[model samples]
Target: MISSIIRTMITEFNNDVDKLSNDLTAQSRNHVITPREANR
Candidate 1:
């Protein structure tokens, strides 16, 4: 039960990261957003 809970949390975290990556890519398409800006 606990392991399943952790797995679900990790999956959600990865999804969030993927979305952020997409957003970063779109923003950087204009050559404006920097690594520092993305970290923010």
Candidate 2:
């Protein structure tokens, strides 16, 4: 039972990390694009 609970927690943690990284990448892309557009 304890092992199952730990496994679930790990899965949830990994999912959260994936979502956070995705959001960061999207924000970084927007930042990169916005500066280039402003320069033009």
Candidate 3:
């Protein structure tokens, strides 16, 4: 049971990272949302 919970958590984490990566890629391609601006 514990292993299953951990696996589910990892899957969700990976999904979140994937979404963030796609968003960053889109922003970079658009050349409007820079890292510096996002840091602010």
Q: Model 3: which residue pairs collide?
A: none
lDDT of each: 0.87, 0.75, 0.82
Order the candidate numbers by lDDT, best to worst: 1, 3, 2
TM-score of each: 0.75, 0.76, 0.78
Model 1 has an lDDT value of 0.87
Top candidate when judged by TM-score against the true structure? 3
lDDT string, candidate 3, 1-40, tens digits: 9999999999999999889877877886788788665444
- Which candidate wins on lDDT? 1
Q: What would you estimate as the lDDT of candidate 3?
A: 0.82
lDDT of 1 by residue, 1-40 (tens): 9999999999999999999888997787777787677767
Query: What does each candidate score in C-alpha RMSD?
Result: 2.2, 7.4, 2.5
What ranges in model 1 sit over 4 Å off?
34-40
